[model samples]
Target: MQPLPLLSGADPTRALDAIFVNAPLRDYGQRPRTNDYTLPVLGMAYIATYSQRAGFNVAVLDAEAHGLGIVETAELVNAARPRWAAMNLLAPTYEMSARIAAHLAPDIALMVGGHHAKAMPDRILADPRMANLRTLVLGEGELRVAALLEDEQRRRELPGVLWRDPLLGTRAAGIPSGKPNPQMLGPDINALPYVNRAFLPQDPYQAAPTETDRRLARNRGTDLLKNAARTGHREANIVGSRGCPYNCTFCGAAVSANPDLSIRVRSPENIIGELDQLHAEYGVTAFRFVDDLFLGAGRVIDEQMAAFTQNRIGERYVWDATGRINVLNRLSDSELDRLVQNGLREVALGIESGSDRILKAMDKRIDAEMTERVAHRLVKHGIGVKGYFILGFPGESHDDIEATVRHIRNLWALADNSPGDIRASVFEFRPYPGTPIWTTLTDAGHSPDALLAYGDVDLTSDGADETMRQRDEFNFSVDIQFGDVPLARVRSTLATLTREQHQRNQATQGAAA
Candidate 1:
C-alpha cells in the first residue's frame, strides 16, 4: 500500500489487511517529537515484516517519525481503512494511546501492544476507556502477529494475544472479553525475517532542536552540532537478542509478560545479511543494537564477532550496544581489543548505583570494583562509555548517595575530568508496573497509579513547575527520594559533578583547537 498524504481526500480503494503504527506517548497533546535521540520504532517494523510475509497487505505509519500529530495520524489511518490497526505503545503514552484508539475505533478493529500492554494487560484491558481496543499482543509480537493475520477465525486462541472475544456470551460484550488471556508466545529470534525498514521514512527522523540544544550551540559554537551532524541523520537500530538473562528487580525487561527468561540470540549470518542490505541500500554505516544485554551470553558475542571478522560485517560499519559490567569484566583484553577493532565504538552500561548494598538489593550481581575496572578498560581502549545511574531506590541512604558521588567523581577523574568522551545519564527511580520492586512497593500499600503520576513530571525540562520538578531541580534528578538524604546536599554534589564535566568538555575543545 502507498503512503497516504495527511490532507489527501483520496481513500484506499480496499481496506488493507493490517496497519502498524508507532505513536508518541506525550500527554499534553502530540508534539512533533518526544525524545532527543529518535530512532525508527524497530519493533513495529518487525511486526509489519511478518504480517506482509504472511500474505497480508500491511501499511506502517511511524507517526512520530513523520512529524504527524494525533489528528493528522488519525486522518492517515482513516484513509487506509485497514481491517485492523496495531500500535506500539510505551508506559508514558498509555493514556494517549487510549485516546487514539477511541478516535479510530468502531470503524477499525484496534489492537494495542508494546511495553505498557505487556506489563499491565489486566489493568489496561479492564479499563472502560479501552473498550474499543480489540486485541493486545503480548510478549514477542512477530510470531503472534503473523498468526493473527493468517488465521482470523482463531485469533483469540493464538498465544501472546489478550484479545476481546466478544462472542462468548451475553457478558462477553464488555470486560469479560479481556478475561482469561491466551498464553504468551515463545518466538525464536533467528527465525524471524529482517525488519521491513521500507515501511519507515527514507530520510530518517531528526529531533527538532530544543532550547537546551539551541543554548549549547550558541555557547559552545558549532562543534557540538557539527559532530552530531557528521554522525548523519540516518542511523538504524537492530536487535540481535531479546530479553536479558539477569533478573534485575528494577527493570521492566526482567519481569516481562513472557514466561521465558532465556536470552534469544539471532544467528550471526542473519544479522550480517541485514547489515549488508542497510549499508548498500540506505548508505547507512552506523547502527544501534537495541538489545537489553548485548553480551548476556558470552558465546553469542564471540560467534558474532567471528562472523563479522570472517564476513567483514564490522569493517564498513560503526555501532553501539548495552552490556552488563560483569559480562564486560569477563572479556579478556585481547577479546575486547578484537571487538574495538571490529567497529565497537561505544557500549552503555547499567551501573545503577555505586553502593554495593544498593546493587545487591537491586540484584545487580556485579559490584562497584568490577564496574570501575571494566569502565576504565573500555575508556583506555578508546571506546566511549555511557554509564546509567539511578539515584533514588526506595531503600538507598545518604551514605549510599555519597558513595555514588564518589564513584562518579572517580569516573570523571579517569578522563582528567572531561565530559568529551566519558559520560553519565541519571534517572530517578520510577516504579513502573509489573517490575519486581514495583510489585513489592504496591504490596506494601503504595499506589502504583500515584507513583506513575509523579514520574510523568518532566525533570529534564527547565520550565517545569511541578512539585517533583522543583525537587528534581534541587537534586539534579527526579522526585523519588530514598532514606534520609537531604535534597540540598544531593543538589550540591550534582552541581559540583556537572561543573567538573563542563571543565572537561572545555579543556578537550581547547586541546582540539
Candidate 2:
C-alpha cells in the first residue's frame, strides 16, 4: 500500500515482514533546519531493539534527519511493504502521521499508540478507521510490544494495551483484549542497550559542536559518576532528575503518573562514574546535560562539587546544561563559583516571558527580575548563559508582547555589559499535545490547526517596539495576533540581525587571521 497520492501497484508481501512508521519531527511539520538529530527518540529505540531481538524484521524511516516529507516517507513504506506496523506519535501530529500510516498500511495490520492513546484510549476505539488496528499500546511500549508478540491472543492479560480483533467477522466480535502496563524506564536506561549507530547519517549534527556526539554517546549518565577517571570533556546525556514536577497552566499536567516527580538525580558520584567511562572509552572532553531543567544548583551541584573536591578531579572537565531561570536567581556566589570551578562553564535558562501578566497566565514561576538577576549572576560567575524565550500564551495581548520586547531590550543592555557572556534565543509558540496549553486551547477551541506550522512572532526583531527599550520581552511568543504590533516583522528583523551577526563574526575571524 502506498501512502497519499500513490498506492501499492506491486506485491506488498515481498517488501518486508514488519515495519513501524517512525515519525520524526519532519514527519509532522517544517522549520528552518538546524543541527541534524538522531531518529531513534531513544525511548522508541528500546522497543525497536527488543522487537528486533524477537527475530522480527524491522526498519525505521527517520524522516526528520533525512528531511523527507510525510508523503515521500509513505512512498518508501509502500515500497518496503511491511505487513504489520506498530506506530504512535503525539496527538497534535497524530492526524498526519496516522493518515500516512493508513495509506502505506492498507492491507497490513496497523497498531497506533502514544500519549494520545494513553490519554484517550476509548475515544480512539470509536473510530472505525482504527478498526483494523491490532493494538494500541499505551504508556511504556517496550514491554507491551514484547508481550503482544509473545501472546498472539492477549486482550485478556496485557495491561495498558488496547486492541481490536486480528480476525474480524470470524465470530469474535467482542473479544476482551489484553491490558499490559509497561513499567516506566529510568535510572537503568543504560542497562537497556546501545542504539544502532547505523541509523544516523554521516556525522549527525556535523555543524554542531563535538559535545553533541558526546551527549549522545558513551558518557550518557547511567548511575551518574560513571566516568570517574576522565581528565577532560566527557560527553553525556542527563538522566532526568525527578521528571518535571509542575503542570503549569500552559503545560499538560497529567502526562505522567506522578505529577510532582520533584527533580531527582543519581548521586553525583554515579554521574561522575559515567563521565569517567566516556573519557576512558571514547576520549570525550566536553559534556552537555540534556535535562529539561537543571535545578541542581544548591544540593546536587554542591554534592557534585564536594565529590570532585574529595576525589581531586577538579578542572578535568567542562559542561553545559539547561535550567530554569529561578535556579540561578537563588544561588549564592559561592555555589556559582563551585559550579564554575568544577567546569560547569555554560548554562541555558528558559525565561518564558517578560510580562508578569503573561508569565502569570502561563504559570511560569519566574519573573523578568528573576531572569535579569540570573543573567547577572551567571555573567559574574563567568558562565556563558543562553536565554530562550517564547511568545504567545493564554491571555497575552499586543501590549503584553510589547512589554515582552521591552523586557528583551532591558535584558540586552544587561547582557551587553557582559558581552559574549550571554546570548539570546527565541522560538514561536507551539502547543504540544498532553500539555495544559494544548488541552486548554483545544478545549477552548482556539488551538492552531497544525502543530507543525511555525508561528510569526520573532523576538530578535528591530521592528520590535524600539520605544520600550527597558521593556524587552525576555521569553515570550505571540500566540495571538498582536493589537498594533506587526508580527513576523520582528522575525524578518531578527533574521537580518542574525545574518549580520554571523557576517561580522566571520569578518573578525578573517581580520584576526
N/CA/C clash count, model 2: 61
**How well does candidate 1 score on lDDT at residue 51?**
75
lDDT of 1 by residue, 95-120 (tens): 65666776784768777788778787
Best by TM-score: 1
lDDT of 1: 0.66
RMSD of each: 6.5, 8.3
- Give candidate 2's error at residue 218 in angstroms: 28
lDDT of 2 by residue, 438-495 (tens): 6667777654444424333334445444322222222234245422444454345344
TM-score, structure 2 vs. true: 0.70
Local distance difference test, each candidate: 0.66, 0.54
Which ranges in model 2 have alpha carbons more than 4 Å from their true place?
1-20, 24-40, 49-59, 78-84, 117-132, 164-191, 194-238, 252-283, 293-298, 303-317, 417-420, 442-513
Clashes (N, CA, C under 3 Å) per candidate: 2, 61
lDDT of 2 at 297: 47
